[model samples]
Target: MTYSGAVTVGGPAEVHELADLMISKAAVGPMNNNAYLLRCRTTDEQLLIDAANEPRTLLALIGDDGIKSVVTTHRHGDHWQALAEVVEATGATTYAGRHDAEGIPVPTDVLVDDGDTIKVGRVELTVRHLVGHTPGSIALIYDDPHGHPHVFTGDCLFPGGPGRTTRPEHFESLMSGLEAKVFVLPDETWIYPGHGNDTTLGAERPHLGEWHERGW
Candidate 1:
């Protein structure tokens, strides 16, 4: 088991440690992609970043109260196909940018826009609406209250790259959002993307020009 792949982040907190539960990438079907399960240390609350090609694997990581909420970065099937199954079992609310509805098709209980905030137990997540890749794509900023800030980039950003914008219009919009949103964060922010090894906002900001040129 691995923290960034198939490993589980488990253990009750001790005197010096807080419960930082996590379930990194499990098998993602034919795509072999990675998904994330980021658990809140203080609250034992879990927030899923993407559904991927997994259902049972996600269930195992999700545990009892189920996941606190499932945040989809964009509408690609690789990121959200397991959603219905998860919702059927966990009853977690789905939150996504309004523009990516076509991919989910299912109704989103929470429709978020830029600057909207979602409270999950002790954590508060702010929405950064990023268009392109698929209009309404977004990244979630988790304010830990006491610990370091975290960002769930979904498909918008990755360890070595940003997401792809299939449409020219989406490409343009995505670049704009990248400059104004994702790149503006502090360096310490842990970027939990839909796939791959996690990186920091500081590590990615310098590559803005290349990402923009790629049309994503």
Candidate 2:
């Protein structure tokens, strides 16, 4: 399957080839939340991100791949609507940001913290705790051996601006995390968000100043 192709019943809506790993994406539910399945080519181990919605659809995408773990980006309802069902079906270990773990439906087996490394087969993903979108919002970074970083930025960072924040303090937290953990990375970094299309750090970096001015 070609990269960036949609993964549906017949195929993946979006497919990304990263070194030894492949990422498949599908948008589900009324919220149009993006659910991602990451597979390790060498080990055949799979890690699923945000079981969003539609248990049947997710299970179909997962097929017999055998999900090793399910990682929830945040406690948002839209992001984990099918978590309980997915876990029951797959018996996969559940992980969530330590601060938001309590809020998610299924009890998180592991509470991830910033700077922690999440193992997917032999691959290692660095975790970054991004606040504002949610106190426990977190993003995972995978440095592909081929170059370019692949980051899954839950609801914290998106294409046009940061995730929705109701207060100035929340916005500040989001901006600070972006500046420190996200924007500081190379422009080639590929971003996979919770919903909609994919974007690169290079494509969004130039507009950071504009985003700040708009106060979104």
Best candidate according to lDDT: 2
Model 1: residues >4 Å from true position, as ranges?
A: 1-27, 167-169, 213-216
Clashes of 2: 9
Question: Residues 20-79, candidate 2, lDDT per residue (tens digit)?
Answer: 998888888688788989999889899999999888889988888779999999998999
Compared with the true structure, model 1 gives a TM-score of 0.81
Model 1, residue 174: what's the lDDT? 72
Give me the candidate number with maximum TM-score: 2
* Local accuracy of candidate 1 as per-residue lDDT tens digits, 77-152: 7777788898888888888887786668657888889999876666677999987777778888865555666777
Tell me the TM-score of each prediction against the true structure.
0.81, 0.95
Error of 2 at 31 (Å): 0.9
RMSD of each: 4.4, 1.7
